[model samples]
Target chain A: MTIQTLNPAQRTIRTVKPMPLARNRFERMAWIFMRFSGLILVFLSLSHFWLQHLIVGTHQLQFGQTVARWGAAGAPVTIENVFWRLYYVAIIALAMLHGLNGFRQVAYDYLNNRGVYRGVMIAATGVIAVVSLMGLVALLGGATIVK
Target chain B: MLNGLVTTVREGARYKGESNQWMWIAHRISGLGVLLFLVTHISGMSFSYFNPKVHEALIEIYKTPLFSVGELFLAACLVFHAINGTRIALLELKPEWWSEQHKATRASLLITFVLGAPTLVIMAWKSLSFYLATGR
Candidate 1:
């Protein structure tokens, strides 16, 4: 005299999972990348703006001024110089990656053509690579900051 | 194409959303502006390595009134984008708080204005006074 239950005829429809339509790991990584990089950038970027724009006047901003901050052109490298160079490198690298990824996101919104989107991303990547390398060479090249 | 992203989130893009739509639009616009500036900016910095003369010329252009004004605008974009981004990250961390997103958006904007305005004003004053003095 036990109550009995019968099996359902078919699988019940599941509720839609609340997740972005990330087609692959890269897409998921990109989503997470924005958040993490953005978190760091919130401090790095704003302080940088304050430093460059507020702390330093427009007229005072010269090529020599920036290079001098990185390190003396011909003087021995100090720990502070290495620190500034690394700080700049972090900002440049992270900002480029974060900013370019954002640009790509917006581009994808308007660019429905897959081929065109791919081409644009490729070009963007090239610019990021070249610019980042250039920044590295400018900040760390011709001088041994490690010493 | 832009409709879905600017208009909705989490829900299917086809659905109409509320004022938070503006935040999405603002983030994209500000981010794009920053990106464009970054390209030219890093290029000029790097040019300091490969080409010193070119870098000096580029830096000179940056000191012009127009570019200084552009610099102010860039600061605005950066500040807004940073605050707004923090809001987005916070909401993402607590998905349930997505219900209060519009409130968060307003707060973030308000905070941005409070913090960013004084700095921007000071920057503008500095830029103007310097240009006046140097006549450059």
Candidate 2:
């Protein structure tokens, strides 16, 4: 018996395309960010729900009482306050990273031209930087930047 | 079947890159949106510990027009992030299941739209009504 093979002209070789430079570190950073944000959110969101909704009960909460608790400064600064601060900052940072990355994804999916892609990325980075810096200031105990 | 021309036209308009790249970006953005809203929500609720007066003040603010709008935006963020997140997860299920992935994503979005629209409407109505009744 003889093995039969196709002519060279009838054969073809295919190689998977390499990823573009535009999608290197940035994509990895975005993926890592989602996991980190998801983890933080699990704790922050749950604790928040427990503290405000379940423990206190929605109807029981009112203004003066709420203010007094935060105002009463002393030993350990209180676990609740600490949690609140951490929750706020972590959520803010995660949100900035996540949202900006999402926008990049949208641009990648929707935009067609190289020039348009670059332009969109620059604009996105600018917006993310400004918003994230503002969020950081607010979360770090500065005067509230957003109402 | 989806019209071949429609699919072709839509794909034609897509960015000259992998679909995964775009999906990856959107997942990040929506996740961040949820995070941002969560921070604001927790901080605002933190006021509840301050004093009843401040708490009431904050509640009234939430009921007011401006903050009410913000709350609606937050709700929008929640819905979009959740739906999009589910889409990303579905895509990662398995290579063998890849063919059905788009169907699942579309179904998820349909369900989201059905649920989200009514919920948002109710939330807005209730919030607005409470404000009017209180005259705050």
Candidate 3:
């Protein structure tokens, strides 16, 4: 009973069997997120490498350069840099979501107890959420670490 | 009350196990691995910024087999997660685009191979080259 969804890019996919007709379609959204994030990562990673390693040259990226680039007053913050930060956050966030969701799917298939399944989802989500928040804070706390 | 406490604890453990099953298992494991590497990688890279001598020294350490093994493992985790993730995403594609989700997954794998292989090679070469030039 696999369900198919249409994408803006005109692609189609056969996914898990649709449970109820009026479900919130959360997994569908998660699936979309993975593709978009993956596509963005391709660009973000490449640009980051090109900028830090190729354009500026790897040797030149000192603390001064890093600080300058981030706090360049009005340098427009280049698309690459903005994407770099977003890429970091997005990959972490999406990876967690995709992975956790996959775990849930597997548990649903193999684990017999429905009660156990719900419990697992809650626990997994809680751990992932807390850790992700901590990671975000650490990543944003550049001043303390970078200097 | 004693029974309740035991039940609560048992339920808690069950939930943790349940949530971390399957793809989530891979996700958590890989996520943790990547995160750990990222922290070390940043710190090591920071050496160059704070002090060139230290930075070069850290880079030099990368030449050893241990570092290579770590890098290889990191690459493997990254590639695996990326490819499988893309497959899942392809499974959500519209019916008009692909008659079957499995087909989409296969195509996604193709794309993954195309991108991942070159990136891995470049990363390895660059890292090795850095170590070779500076015997720090």
Interface DockQ per candidate: 0.49, 0.14, 0.09
What fraction of the true interface does each of the listed models get right, in terms of native contacts kept? 0.64, 0.08, 0.03
Quote the lDDT for B49 in model 3: 33
Best model number under DockQ? 1
Candidate 1 off by > 4 Å: A1-23, A142-147, B1-16
Model 1 chain A worst lDDT run, 10 consecutive residues:
A138-147
> Per-model TM-score of chain A alone?
0.75, 0.56, 0.53
| B14-100: candidate 3 lDDT, tens digit per residue | 765442234445644555565456546655643433454665667556656577657666765666566655555445454465556
**How far out, in Å, is residue A77 in model 3?**
9.3
Interface RMSD of 3: 9.2
Clashes of each: 0, 26, 9
Tens digits of per-residue lDDT, candidate 2, A33-100, equal 66556555545544554455334533344544443343333324566656555666676676566666
Best by lDDT: 1
- 1 or 2, which is superior by DockQ? 1
In order, candidate lDDTs are 0.80, 0.56, 0.56
Can you give the TM-score per candidate against the true fold? Answer: 0.82, 0.53, 0.50
Q: Which regions of candidate 3 are displaced past 4 Å?
A: A1-87, A107-123, A145-147, B1-67, B76-91, B97-110, B133-136
Sort the candidates on TM-score, descending order.
1, 2, 3
Candidate 2: TM-score of chain A is 0.56
- Error of model 1, residue A128, in angstroms: 1.7
Instruction: Indicate the TM-score of model 3.
Output: 0.50
